[model samples]
Target: MSNPLQLEVERLLALGRTPEALAAGEAMASDWARQGQPLRALALCRVLLQLEPAHTRTPQLLADLYARPDAPAKGAPPAAAATLPRVPLFSQLGREPFMALLGALELRTFKAGQNLITEGEPGRSMFALADGQVDVVRLLEGGERRTLASMGEGEFFGEIALVSESPRLASVVATRHTVALELIRTRLERIALRYPAVGETVRTFYRERLLANVLRSNPVFTTLPPEQRQALARCFELRLVDAGTVIIEQGQKGDGLYLLLQGQCTPVLRHPDGKQSAFSSLREGDVFGEISLLLGQPASATVRAETPCHLLRLGRDAFEQNLASQPRVRAALMRLGTERLLHISKLLSGRAALEGDLRV
Candidate 1:
């Protein structure tokens, strides 16, 4: 059977590695012609000649790549053809505009088990995989490696690093021979200038995904309905709280709920007698300062960032405002609050029983 040379070429183009890609495209054309598959050969030839027109065979290939079957009307969209999953940027732009934008992008590819990103390195572009899978990895305290997750074709990553102008949080290693579409930050900024909505879409997508991840990890919110979960997500803002920062002060009116998205925090309780105790330590997905928000009272305890926490804060006023404007959001918040109350009540009751047993 003949190889899918055209598909392979598409993969390379998606990755923004054009120089070597041009050579691969030529090879595909040669192979196709050797197999007497003129149409396939012509498609690849067009791509090559587009890069280097003076190549002796350029004119003939150009004629063939543009050649049309008898039935189609002029200017009609090419007959429904198989294609890679649309990269997010192109998908957002639609057909004509996407193709227009593509003219300016470079193509690239990666071998299996290659690292696409590394922690602490500057990230100036985002990638969209057109084929193969990549593993998102991180190193642990003991130098042990862990797979945070894996993403496959049509999935996009490296976006947050570009948008936030921060170093990548996790490294991405290709698990299999891969081809990805890359959009440089400069190009993205240019597109954002022309189509601001695209930027908004990206931001909205980022926030929702981040919220969903944090919420999913907490037993408190994961059981809610999809619509409710989404509404709760909207009320939240993700913020990075530096280590040693005071996130909540005891005796101050609490206006927001804080969910740890990453890192840890220490909760401190101070008695009227001047006694102080470290009540608990929290890690990712743990939440604090929520009881005050729920009760509309002053904070009972202070919480300080222990190790540079990433937090998702949902302020009471914002929640109420969103509820007023969007009834569904209010419903979701109410449901979550009710569930949380029940959960805390159970925990408190269990602790009380343990104390009673100790006394006995």
Candidate 2:
């Protein structure tokens, strides 16, 4: 389906309403960024940059948006522990284990403007900043550079890549002469296997980070207090489903609510007569299956992954056990469900009207 915002921007641009289109695009981009969907925000920014290449503020805005801090990951705890410092990932370990981890780390330095990690390169290890600063920049299509963030003393980067054994999402460059301690995955794995406590600490930290990001991204969870959000986060189970997988079949009993952390899915309604129509798409930060879960009814539509999806699922039992005490969350979910139902009603009405017009 065509994006209403994009269509509006295009219409304005066709009418030579450059200023209006720019303003609209800027507002939409800011909204998307606030909703924690950076890629969508960046897409809007790209359009604005393309139309107004000379607009100085657009580039700066893109940079600022990119520079917004992500949920903190495992990092060095303190500089007083050892030469490498006490990182949270090793916080629970005894002195011997901690020292062992510290010994495994290799201290590295880079000159100003030197790249410590490049986008799309395999990440074999994670790094903890010991001194100086590093800038995280993502290269966009057509060779544009967007600065994602900056890191200083004790901050961690590349942990996600290391954990998932995936390519780096962005490049990390030394903004100045910098010192960092590199933790190779293999060494870390060995330490973790030998010390279950160390492994659990890292796992807990990563899970918390994932939960925090999902909570921040999703509008329904935004109203939840930090403590409550943390409580709810612990109740979720992470699942990775492959592309084209049907997650929730239409008319099936809904057992849980799902929060999409990464990738996209489409909610499609299938009629008994074998007709199917996708009404909307869900991307990162979007929640689904809540309607059925809350109402204790069958799912109204099928949800299929459009890409490999990373999801956090909160089953009804967990929701009742963990979230029932939070009246605010319950109220929020009810309100969201109402809004979603209304949206579906509108979509159906619009389709019916179009069908009627076509028949005439």
Candidate 3:
């Protein structure tokens, strides 16, 4: 720590201006880290301990600056506590914790046509748009990308990155010059260490937001009332699987209903005679395990993940409690099961015809 800067910060503490003292210390530390001087950064840590260890921002500040060797060089510029306007996304956070989280957010600027988040990339942070506009998009099986929504100021996206280590579910591109605040993954982890409730709130908020969207759009769930859908979303537990992992094996008992929220899967049909065939790929908004659940039979096919997947599973009891009363939902699900069964027949018939042609 530089003597002049250290002395000024100590003076603030002595004058009972504790918040000012922490701010000054944090700024000095940030500057030292930005300068890429490890010794100066380390010295500030000791000074923070001596001055006022109880309320020091040293841990978070140091973690932010030097946690990863490349963090200082590649990280976004730090944002002040009061930098962002009223963001409704953080509205769930209490005043004190929200302020703390706000201070951790970094300022990011993007030009028009810049990619904020890319589909299928590792996501370590989420963003809150402070100004300008962005488009959220998803990739289709046809190798085309579709805009899911256009967001302007006060909207936030990428919350799932904070909770799940899976790849990003979609991409966000700036439509114009944009200013946003980014809350990185590690900082949120540290904050969660200090504020458990804050961590739960964020995790819960992400889950509800993620699953609620699925429930609203899914045809089987659409017949249920909104409140029921929300309640049903809560009943479903999140499950993630890496590429090539078999979600359900052929001829096995189904767990319940699994709604694919992100990524793709392929249903592999294994015949008793040892031939295997993969049916069409299953993408977002596709649901599986329903055939077994609805008919009380073993799964008809093996489902394997084609990519890193995020899924929500409703257990047998929960599925019954939630959808058993809804006749339309059950009927719709039954129809889907019948269609899948027909698809299975068609695949088997195609393979048999190919074998017969080869014999001919």
- By TM-score, who's the top model here? 3
Per-residue accuracy of model 2 over 264-320 as CA lDDT, tens digit each: 898887666676767557876777887887788788788999977778899989987
Query: Which wins on lDDT, candidate 1 or candidate 2?
Result: 2
Comparison by TM-score, 1 against 3, better one = 3
Could you tell me which residue pairs clash in candidate 2? Answer: 76-87, 77-86, 77-87
**Candidate 3 Cα outliers beyond 4 Å, as residue runs:** 1-91, 94-96, 137-146, 165-170, 347-360
**What digit string (tens of lDDT, one per residue) describes model 3 on residues 110-214?**
878999999889889988765568999999899999998999766678888887766787889999777666789899999888878778778677778878888
Better of 2 and 3 by TM-score: 3
* lDDT per model vs. reference: 0.60, 0.67, 0.71
Best to worst by TM-score, what's the order? 3, 2, 1
* C-alpha RMSD between model 2 and the true structure: 18.7
TM-score of each prediction: 0.61, 0.65, 0.68
In model 1, the Cα lDDT at residue 289 comes to: 61
What would the TM-score be for candidate 2 when compared with the true structure?
0.65
The alpha-carbon lDDT assigned to residue 135 of candidate 1 equals 95
